[model samples]
Target: MYRTSWSCQSRFVIHRTLVAYRTKGMPVPRPRLMLAVILFAQFVIPLSISGTAVALPEIASTLGASPTPLQWVVNGFNVAFAVCTIVWGVCSDRIGYTRSFQIGIVIAALGGVLSTFATNIALLDTGRVIAGIGSAAVLTGAAPILSHLFHGADRAKAFALFGTINGLGLAAGPALSGLLMSAWGWRGIFAAHTIVLLLALVGSMRLPLLGRANTSLRQILDFSALKAPKFLTMTLVPMAGAIGFVTFLTYLPSALGAIHSLAAGATGALMLIMTIPVLIAPVLVHRVLERTRITPTGIVAASFACLILGGVGVLMLLRPDLPVALGVAPMILLGLGFGLPLGIVDAEALAAVPAERAGAASGVINLFRIGSEAVFVALFAVILATVVTTALPGRSGQLVASGEHGHPWIYHDGLLAAGITMIGIVIVLGIVFFALTRAVSRTPALGEQLGEQ
Candidate 1:
């Protein structure tokens, strides 16, 4: 009896010691409410970007900015968003997710207010660029911020929520832009963004910090955490995915306009059609696919295939009769291609490094994607400009002073550019995905046999 009691006591002590060791920096095990708020903030960053895109014409006319420089309004935010992600990621690890995120909200508010008073295009872009910086700060901190709030199954759920919210924000931006634009015009949009920033700031402050006391800049970021191979793939695959996506979204709007003569509501409807699949994928992934043991590489390879099919599908829309709705068919596949990679890549990216450094990993990935976004956005714009400048004016354009003469040929400059570029991405993604897929597996045989399926 004595021996058994002592042994039991010893085991109890050992178990408690292990638990203590596990909880070192983890203050509270999980905070679901905080995760919810963090995801809501995630909703705002892309909200601003997509919202602004829908309101571009209004912004240009209100500011007296011409069509060419107007692209900067959109570019400015993205540029800052892309550039600041890495910096904020490192900062979050050093400081604390809550504090870093608050700082971001404050910075974004300042940018919003400043943008309202700009007299010229440069000033406006400057304000947007400033806002972009803040936007980057917020996004960079979001994933890392939530790491402590979840782990294991909860962590997967948190990521799914974050991704779904993000997809919704992007999909909703256009419609929200239209609503805000119709009601308040250009300045109203800025005012709304400022309001959003302030609200997020206030809401962010209320989030209980899961017992975190770390408030150092180092909490926001750290450089040493980025040596992992999975982290590298996380960064590159997403960028490649972003390039594929940016290629389509870049030209898709115009393609619809030319092919279907889709009006504003119709365009939003088409985007809705594409985004629906994205939202569904996350849920299905959580409920169904998570049950199976699946490799991230296999999923990404599937995504690459989706990109290829989506690109080809869009090119097919160039046909006179789309049979189905405009962009409905192609967008279905495109969203599959775009959504799966984004879902898997980002989730894995966060899981790749230490929870402490997930933000930094996110930032590294953002750097690659942002760089790609800039290049592709510019490339897409050039395509549009080429088509617009060279095409002959329509009868409707004769009525409007601002309307440009669009290309006369079927799939003229911009459309053709989009088609070729998308196909190029399809090929590049195929090679890179296949090569990378093989590298990660034990044997090349495990990787999907190219041309086998």
Candidate 2:
């Protein structure tokens, strides 16, 4: 009896010691704290992007801005974001990731402050552009930081969480912005953004220390990484998502209203059915990786297949004879198709490159992701309008493009052609994806090179 009592006491002491060491070892384990900071900052970036649209009407009303200036409120930020991501990516490697991240937070906070108090439309647009430039740094800096901080499976999970947070920001942004606008007016959104970025700047101090790239300017500028078949393929995966899923996401509301005549509130509510899968899919994919022996290539293949299937299923939306309820399942499929590969592709793309160039690689990959979303969405709209023009022409086609009252059959036909075209692009991308994945796995030299890094 005495011996048993002693053993229990000994075990208790050991457990307490371990707990103390963990607590005293660092102020909240670096990984968890840093991940929190990164995720927090990442969440707000997309939130600002999507949520700002909700404020546009209010912004125009208060500022007395014309349509052209009002449009730049969104476009200016996007143009800056796309252009600066590459700049910040290369800069992060030169100055250091943590430094670049903090600088971005500062810049973003400044932009947010400017936007919050701006009296004129031009000032607000300039503030947004500045914020976008800052956001580019965060996006480019965050990935490479994670690439270096976590390795193998941990890296996968970290990025999975990263992607999940991004989706949440995008999905939740408009609603949150609307709520804030109701309570504190349009400036509340930018004020809230500034406050969050300030907090993120504080948290960044605790990030794990990492060194800047020692590579020569020529090496840093080397386009060789882009030449790798595996690297190019991994980069294209997100581009596929951008074209196949995001383009639809951007245009779906118009389709809903023009085709099925859903009200704004109803359309927003129905969108949740599709968006919920995106929020949960990264977690699900992480579980699949943890439990199963599925290779990354296999995961990529399955995701692309889901996208193709979802694309076909969404054709049901173009048919007026079909129930709107029928499109729900396909929308969910499209969410899964995009979400499943979100983080996995980031990890895979980084792994394909040398460690020293991960920062630059991250910039390029994001450029494709953001650039494609912007470009393809515009392209898809043009295609839809062109198709509609052939059938209905002039004002009717214009109304169809904008989802105002128009010829339902003509709009349906236009959407069908655009959907079919998008599917063809995704299919071609899938074939290319497969060829590249196979090539990467077979190339021992590439593996050895990455191993050396």
Candidate 3:
């Protein structure tokens, strides 16, 4: 009887073990490995975005493309990234985050293959677009995977790493691209990019699954958050920066080449003055928030002031009379202006709405943020090209816009026109931002607002 009882208990324990294993789904990678993979993937997306700017001159020279088509090399990526980010966000919910992220890596690697071998400008831009779409999936899938993998303090740390990795990529992109371009020419940059993506893809294969999809949470795009005036105003801050700063960031290498006749290596080194602040300013802003009582609104106001000055300061480059060193100060100012309110505004915007709508609010704000970048950057390029056409007309104007060696005087009118146009937009945005911030009461911390939920 004692032997029979022991056998029954052993069978019962084994049965429970099997049931628990099935309930938890398939075994996955250890959490630490997953974190590393997610962070690695995050780093490359922004690297690809900002690094490609350094390659534009080479692409132009190699393909002999005109200005308008050349602009698409950058714009095609931005527009595709902006649109696909939303699609990937929704798809992650249905197909599981791990799968979505793996698919993204595969697609991006394929795109890099195309980019590495392309002989024509059109083929190159198409590769960039495919890469952009894949980048969106990686970004959208990261947060969900991290959220599921960690809890409380660990979760916060994981996200902090996420943000830091993004900033690092943006900071390091141009310099790395320049190094590769110098060593093996432009195709080397894309080849290195492809290699990195393939490594990420291999790592992703080990990621633990997040179980079956949660189809019950399906909801369409929600814009109910836009009704709040304060939220709307806060959203405009980044949009303003997108117009005032990102456009300049993307095209500055070309501008430098045009004005100072610098080579690709030198231009990339110079861009560090602008991008390094973007990497560090968020940390500075966080410290200031903790140590002082300065309001988010005040911080934003200061950001606006910096952007306006930075815009005007960049116009100094258009003058043949000013020293090139003067450009450094404005570049730092623009970087600070964009970086000061980086993560703060997103939290503040979400805090403005009801707790339940926080997710929707985030989606709305991101869409606007990306859409503004796509629209304004395209506009900036078009305005610059149009002005150049009017001044020089036909092929000479096209060549100058494409960053071929040209007299500094030829770029003066085009740069001046584009600079002034951006400044005017920033000023108008500032006026609206200030008015709306005053209309609302001081915002509470996001943690405080969302505590009940």
TM-score of each: 0.73, 0.71, 0.83
Worst lDDT run of 10 residues, candidate 1, spans: 396-405
lDDT, ranked from best to worst:
3, 2, 1
Model 2 misplacement above 4 A? 1-31, 48-71, 90-99, 113-124, 144-160, 171-192, 205-211, 215-223, 253-265, 286-295, 315-323, 347-367, 378-421, 438-442, 449-453
| Model 3 poorest 10 in a row by lDDT | 212-221
In terms of TM-score, which candidate is strongest? 3
Q: Which lDDT tens digits does candidate 2 get at residues 1-453?
A: 123322343334334434654776854334566779998888777676555655654675587435445545665666677778778877888878778888888998899999999999899989988998898888877877776565444555566677667667755555566667767888998999999999998998777544464444344344566666878888778888877876676556557767887654455566676677777887788898999998777777877887889888987654677888999888888888888887578787777765556545654666677677555655566677677667866544555555543466777777788888888999999999888877876765443565565
Better of 1 and 2 by lDDT: 2
Q: In model 2, what is the error at residue 390, expressed in angstroms?
A: 11
lDDT of model 3, residue 100 = 85
What is the overall TM-score of model 3 with all chains considered together? 0.83
What number of clashing residue pairs does each candidate have, in the order they appear?
16, 0, 0
lDDT of 3: 0.73
State the lDDT of candidate 3 residue by residue for 1-453, as single tens digits.
123322343334334434555687744344567789988877777677567767777887788657767777777777787788879977888888888888888888888899899999899989888988988888777766665555433544555576556556655677788778888888998899899888888898777655433222232135544555777887898789778887777667777777778788888888888787877888888888889998788788888888889878888753566777888899889888888887687767756665444444555665676567656766777887788767877767777776655756777677778878988999999998888776655665434444454
Local accuracy by lDDT, each model: 0.59, 0.71, 0.73
Write one digit per residue (lDDT tens) for candidate 1, span 203-293. 7765544233343334434434344334555566655555666555644544554445554455555666666766676556554456877
